[model samples]
Target: MTVNARSGLPKDRPAAPAPPPPPGWRRWLVPVGVLITLVLLFLPGMGRGPAQVDYGDLAQQVAAKQVDTLRLTADGTITGTYASSFDGGEDFVSHYPTGLQGVDDTFLSQVRDPSVVPHFQATGATGSWLGTLLALLPFLLFLGFFLYIGRAARKGMAGGLGGIPGVGRSKAKVIDAVRPDTTFADVAGYEGVKRDVTEVVDFLRHAEKYAAAGAVAPRGVLMAGPPGTGKTLLARAVAGEAEVPFFSMTGSGFVEMFVGVGAARVRDLFAEARKRAPAIIFIDEIDAIGQRRGSGMASNDEREQTLNQLLAEMDGFDPATGIVVMAATNRPETLDAALLRPGRFDRQVTVPLPTQPERRAILAVHAAGKHLAADVDLDTAARATPGFSGADLANLMNEAAIVAVRDDRTQLTAADLSQARDRIILGQRQGANFLLESEKRNVAVHESGHALVAALSPAADPVDRVTILPSGMALGVTEQMPEEERHLYSEEQMLASLAVRLGGRGAELVVFGEGSTGASNDLASATGLATRMVREFGLSPALGPVGYSSDSPQYLGGEQVTSRAYSEETQRVIDTEVARLVREAETTAVELLRSHRPALEALTRQLLEHETVTGAVVHAIAAGSTADGATRAPVSA
Candidate 1:
């Protein structure tokens, strides 16, 4: 089967042929009818009928023997042919004065001369049929306009923009069962996630098997994870594996500015899904419309109504009907509980960040068509990345390729991958010419301080690289990578982390007798970590091992306001403990830097020379070895 490049759907069979066009003459029938109607409507006005003449002028013309013919109607309108000499016109019309009984004697005296009088006739008559029709033309046009508006109103009532078809309909893109493209094989990792969704795929492919066992399938599955964890990709894999119709949409698609439009869209979406039974309806980012209802004044009535309709549809659909709803959201904590209940989203799959092996696998998948140098070790790259998601890994591979292209190289090398990782984590590197010599020296010292503390601290992760080169918002950076993945951290490890974070500030104070704004981010990070240690981790002795932090979302990063559960006096204690922890960490960093003053100076000087230094060189300098691998005696504080 050939795959469509744009849509990624398979084309195993030919598309259905379009209906034949109508007969040639029939195509012009509507346009011809419209033309005829317009001509008939405007024909009377198009012709210049008769020129109006005054009654006195007509009498003078008749008395002068210039009038050739005359006909007077009961309504006192006189129309007749006249000599061109009378008024340079052959035909004329005149209205008698309404005050006159008939053609008055004054007007009749002009026609009394037998020689002057032309042909004359008096007839009590009404207007011709065409004139009558012309008189009602306005009413007919108004009726046509009213019908056009009424038709538009009816279309609007049917949930469509007036005259525009399918504006209010669901915007889901449906993939036919035969066009399933991304199977499980295409997904690199998330084995557990794939396993969890496999049952749904099986049920979709073979509903009779479950029916025979009297087992009901789950109506919906919710994939909750951090952003870029491949939740949507997993849903696509399910569609491919099941070989069933796939209806995909985002939660935000259901909402519209118009009231009741969101609910209407929800109904329309489900109706379309029902028409394609055994289909998988995947809604990406369901939290957009599935947030907890009536939470606060921020609650949106339209979104709430949409959520209500979705709940109704999910509950209303039968498992036997073979329609499974799958939704994904990074902010699952914000979703309404009804969506996660049994019979709705019976299963909630958590797609967390990839482990080292999974990262390696994901890298391999993204690297399939890319040209890589022989020395580019993906395993090492994976090990360096601890908390990277599948999408991040994919982006990493692409960024590495971009780096290679930027350097005018065809094959991505290890250096390209390393630079890409640094760009991702520490932001893009700034030009070397941007920093002044003095600023560069200070940055070198600051980064050296961080590297020294991280290398010396037993509980801290190993320093990976140190650089005086400015990147992103920072003038310098010291990156540390863990030797292995760690799910939990000890109190010592947290304290060590705090010290490493404050190392730059400590260096600033020790070397320059002052601090700079460069440490502002470090201070904030240290303070927040210390606060969490005291309040959430219950690490502070004064806090009595009691957790005090509110339950905020784990994956979704945002601040939430919550009233402190503890008293004001307890708050004071909490603050005191947090300050003390931060002070102790800073003090440790200061003392460690002071003791390793010679090593710090050596590392800083090396950074000044090279602008970038590896962890091995930093480790060597910290262990009483010079930058050139020569032995040196350690200096005391």
Candidate 2:
């Protein structure tokens, strides 16, 4: 039964409390405008301060003994406050030339006469630049202080301004549209995943029906898959289908350097999600915080608190409230068990790599915007990519478009797709290196050997192309084409595959009477395959159905710690068996090359002439024909 069938929660509930306000353009504009106004008001204004009086008027007043006190500035400006009975009392200011020493002396002489003397003393300088600046310093300080405050207000507390309290607030991005933009139709594959999520969406959309039937909706669904497998996209599609509020946040968004901060965010996120009932809360990359508790050497109090808060929220929420928590993580193996318990993330859906038909659907979806040439067959492209995720397929389509644009082509052709695939698989192919004729011949012979062995071996994949041109780290490459995906390989196929890998060195040994460093990659690959066959696949008779290697997490870049499960004696036997397998494969490759020595020579000559030889060309040479039967013509470089 689906999660909807299991849920017995009621649908009827009262209105929720008001949610914390979402940030918007209006919220930002108010504080930003205030800051801008403060900036305008605080900028230095035009014109001088106070009233002005001529230097002559000030001297006449001094001559009449009307001034009570006087002050002179370094810039030759004067100020004096008039007596109580005098005009312009206490607020008068005046400017005079710096060369007015004669006037000042005359005034002093007049003042010496007791009867005409005014209470005037040469006080400290007034109206100096430094003095004026010092006078306005307090106002400037106020303006700067306010400007900083305004900026802080505009950015909100999340900019680390609000201290511990602000950091505790939720960081979820709420989407309250009638429907999300990305529907299930937009997603390409993972039908099983879609079905699992569809049941949740149906329960959300029709909760009353399920409630009437005494069913309660699932509280949570966890999506576990490798990166780029559309986990997040599927969550969006679920939201779109349910037509409810969607609150999205990454697991890392809840974490902070401070203790209890992540927990606060977790509480805040759930509180807001509850405010919008029938909502989908999606936490992407949840393993960031939900990692198995106590796994680290030192304690991660912040992450642990966040995980605990999440667990509590999931447990505390009523299924009747119509809040379903959905989370995605590439490293599901690292998540805490509490987070995946029955009432929490009740269902864990695995979105695996697309199968053949699923891949075709993915290709078709990604190809919608591109103009494809008639020769571009999506089915063929799908068959070529065995382990590509949905994101990889999208990237492939984009790379194909880029290839088309680079080549100045109007539409994407089969050749563009092929080149894009090669670029993704092996790094970009390099131009011919400036090697000697002998070196070139050696590379051609090596590649030809690989193609020859692959074609002649009973269970080996067919050779797709052989090239002597440098590509990435390889000086030569022989691409193989599997007709279909193979999950379970027989012992015969594994041995044949191992022999094909060793064919380059076998040919080098037969032709040059010694192997060069050119076979380093080939030997490494053959050794790895042989080791797996003996230790992991239990293919060695000597090892006798024993698996000496432990399995690691499946996701790429996941923890790859593999401990040997066997004792030292078994390890020695394993090493011996792996070496024996490699030797036998090499021997088989050498025998095949020797038996078809003439064909091998002919294929090597073709590669030398063309610089690149198609698989059709290799097959023709192996079949003693000059024309490529597969292509109905002589294939070129």
Candidate 3:
């Protein structure tokens, strides 16, 4: 249903709201606004005395005496009157200005008693009863509206603040009908991932290949990748590439906080998918319901039950039937191994971060309709982003265009793109993080050393940006963009890049003869990299040239393989090797600092003043660097 943003009403439903009849309380508001406005308008003149008489004692007195001949003064004060029955038109010649107070209090003695003068004051009151009712009209209208919505939610028309009991059973989205806009062109890099997905797409597109050949095509492919790597999008691309129905829904959506519903929903999803033969079921974030059993989740028993149902349906795949399943999740380790066995998932494809060329392609695709400034170099932009994924690049383009729009520019410039990049990567550089002079100096030196060391290393690339300004998660950041995109890295290059990760700490220690905690992130990054090199890359002498564990998702996904990757002796050797790398890199950075002390001071001073340093600026000092590192769901239409 289409909704009208202005009226907050359903476009198709055209409700005849009875002019909302100035809700009982809505009537109160206008009178309230008027009353408030009038109070504001009239209260200021409370002391002003008007020429009009506020006291009407004469009018009362005349009425009490039944004086028809009473006269009103031009000053609106009572001046003349005489209609005393006792006087019988004799006209009493007694005179003083005729105010009711001027008469004697006891004028009529007893025989046929009559009363004398009285006192009067004109009282002003505003906001009649009708006006007050109108004033509160709006409030009453809103109350009725919310009540209607609340009731509707409870009755299951629109899922209430809490869904109706049967809602969990109805959560699966029929995706082939959804037909997302993503195709293969929308995805880039990860050729290995594409190759793995290609087989599945081929099977969906040509069901006869396996049927005629007496071989079964894979029934499912589990997409396992780190966050921001476009796993969900890859699923959409597969759907776009295939000539079958696609059903997409998140794994988490199947498991509501409500109990017993997850298992029922899982069964329902597969049953529905099966009915749509030659269909693709893409469940993004499958780990939500696919976690290992006995994880102490309160619903572990039920969740595992849900997993069992899902595995059974996935397992009993009949190629002749033409139904397939694909799921995406970052935490693949948590899933049940039974769900990912060869007969079930059969394959795992890893969608990775885009290479430089791929990033440029992604940028171009996103920037297609936007006006570009002459200074916007696609190569430079791609190089400036080393770790950005396809989604990040797309977001960068969107942010740049937004900046251009905000600044009222006809085109997006390189500087605008760079600013947008920083905004996306580090968050806005807020002015609120005021730093002391000493702290500022220390941060500048630390970041500048990172820039210089990366630039000086042959394995590392030139520094793209170095900034001392604070962002969402950091006091400062130094970014290094690659010269070109790289996939495979040499052992030397990896080691060199690791050295630069230690450079900031090295500079702090060498310059001040001690170090601060500014190197926390860098230390963690270096440590993890060194550890991976040992455990996975076989860089440690204790474990050479072979991965001890089958960490590959093809075999490891959903499995509960708890054995250590290496023996205790091997772990000690691995730790020593990592420490040796860190210590050696520290020594190298210190030596460079001692030799280029003057230049180091200059760079840091410049950073303090500018708050940002460019790649060219860092290259001018040092010259090296390297290292490394969705899905429409458905359409109701």
Candidate 4:
């Protein structure tokens, strides 16, 4: 259901909003004109007939030039008869000497054509005017037909009224405030974002406080977040909270193949926003219009015009009138600098990924009425998920309920929750994907290394699940469930985490004497984590606590701040450091494996049959190494 522009609350008795008017003339007139032209320029048909002749009289005329016999029957009908030197085919042998050859008197007594005797007395005839007209009509009809079809062909080739290329049109969606479902309560994990945005809403709700303080309220709020992180939702929530007319649309909505449409729409939007005065304008994914200009040879004049109008409108607005503009985008890097500066988008708020505690809270929100069994622990579930966002948490709850329903259960079980986590992170189990037994064994060993190292390290996160089932990229995943929600990770903790990642490839080298290409994801992850450690965190021997990113512009338009975070002389050292970190962990694992080879073999056998085995199962086997050690139990149900 769509929202109402004037009211923030869900409209109990919905208003019949007027439908948007039809699009530009290019959408219809061009097509209709082509159709008319085609009909007007069409082609027509032609037919054939045989030659008419009279043989007896023609031959006689040719033989005797002067006494030419006429092979004519009275009333212009004639029949043929063969003879020497020409003969007259008279209707009833004319009473005079008709210049007829082989005329015999016996012929009259032999037979008589009964009907012929009556018509023998008649003579003389005219012509057929209708037939003559028909014989001359084909050329003009054919000319007109060709003309019509040819015109149609030309129009079809042109493709548009003006015959322009690149008919790429942007989508249009407008948000109304009345039917909006998002509230401040629906948004999760973005406290800073919420606080900053709440102020904007407050400014919209009560402008006198800010104005009286001589601190003019923000003209525009730029919400920056990755996709699916609810920047759009927050914008709607602002309108919902403020109780004002909200004009919501997308950045792409204004753009068109015709150059000036975007700029025109920008002017129209702000004009309407200002007219409404105490109003809010929300543009979701506004970067489509605000992208950096002059990056390539193509002119950004169209976008520039649109942005210029937007900037002018934003700057020209009176603070007392209470017009708040809000826009959201994932790529802040791509936006124009002028749009992000003080007067235009006066404030920028970011909504990032949810922390563990936030995930638990989000899960609780979704799990409220679902029969999630008293034994279901959201805290544990949250800890089990590391990179989950608000949307992911919502899906996790929904998927758990689906699993419950599929299992024909009245309440969601711990096993169901575990399965939900698996489905959310890895993927649904494919029953029969192909894999050689040898390759499967190798995958099992590789993932086992990750789970083992993660479990063994005191600094590492709690191990969640290890599986050989493939998803988007990795063939297997070793999910590490954290002990609790953590605000930050120490430099030592980050290093250990890197070690855990390398453990997979390390184990491959330890056992098989060489690493397979299966470790591509692992290597990429390790490299990224290590790079951040040096460049961002300044944890390298070559560099001090001075961050390289600090010197780099917030807009990232500048150059390098150092001669590499680590130099060519240090490249080998960094590689050695990384390799040293990896090797030490591998040796530890290999020694551990050597001591508990039997357990590793048993677990690998179990994985081959199950396709997925949880952290609890692996921990059980590892803990079983001791005669009296307690296994890490599953989250109880």
RMSD per model, one decimal: 10.7, 8.4, 15.6, 13.7
Per-residue accuracy of model 4 over 116-164 as CA lDDT, tens digit each: 2211122354345545545655975788666754654465522221223
| Candidate that scores best on TM-score | 1
Ten contiguous residues minimizing lDDT sum, candidate 3? 628-637
Could you tell me the TM-score of candidate 2?
Answer: 0.74
What TM-score would every model get versus the actual structure?
0.75, 0.74, 0.61, 0.65
Q: Candidate 2 lDDT, tens digit per residue, 298-375? A: 778878888988888888644325788899999898899888889898888998888888999999999997899999
For residue 531, what is the lDDT in candidate 3? 80
Among residues 3 or more apart in sequence or in different chains, the pairs in candidate 4 whose N, CA or C atoms overlap within 3 Å are 3-179, 4-178, 4-179, 41-148, 41-149, 42-145, 42-148, 43-145
Please give, for residues 415-498, the per-residue lDDT of candidate 3 as tens digits: 889889889878886684577788888889899778767766667766778989888677888887766677788888887788
Error of 3 at 138 (Å): 33
Order of candidate numbers by lDDT, starting with the best: 1, 2, 3, 4
Superposed Cα deviation of residue 382, candidate 2 (Å): 1.3
Compared with the true structure, the alpha-carbon lDDT of candidate 4 equals 0.66
Runs with alpha carbons beyond 4 Å of true place in candidate 3: 1-168, 175-178, 189-205, 238-243, 256-260, 294-299, 317-320, 486-495, 505-514, 520-581, 622-637
Task: Report how far off residue 364 is in candidate 4 (Å).
Answer: 2.6
Clashing pairs in 2: 7-215, 7-216, 8-215, 8-216, 9-216
- All models: lDDT? 0.82, 0.80, 0.70, 0.66
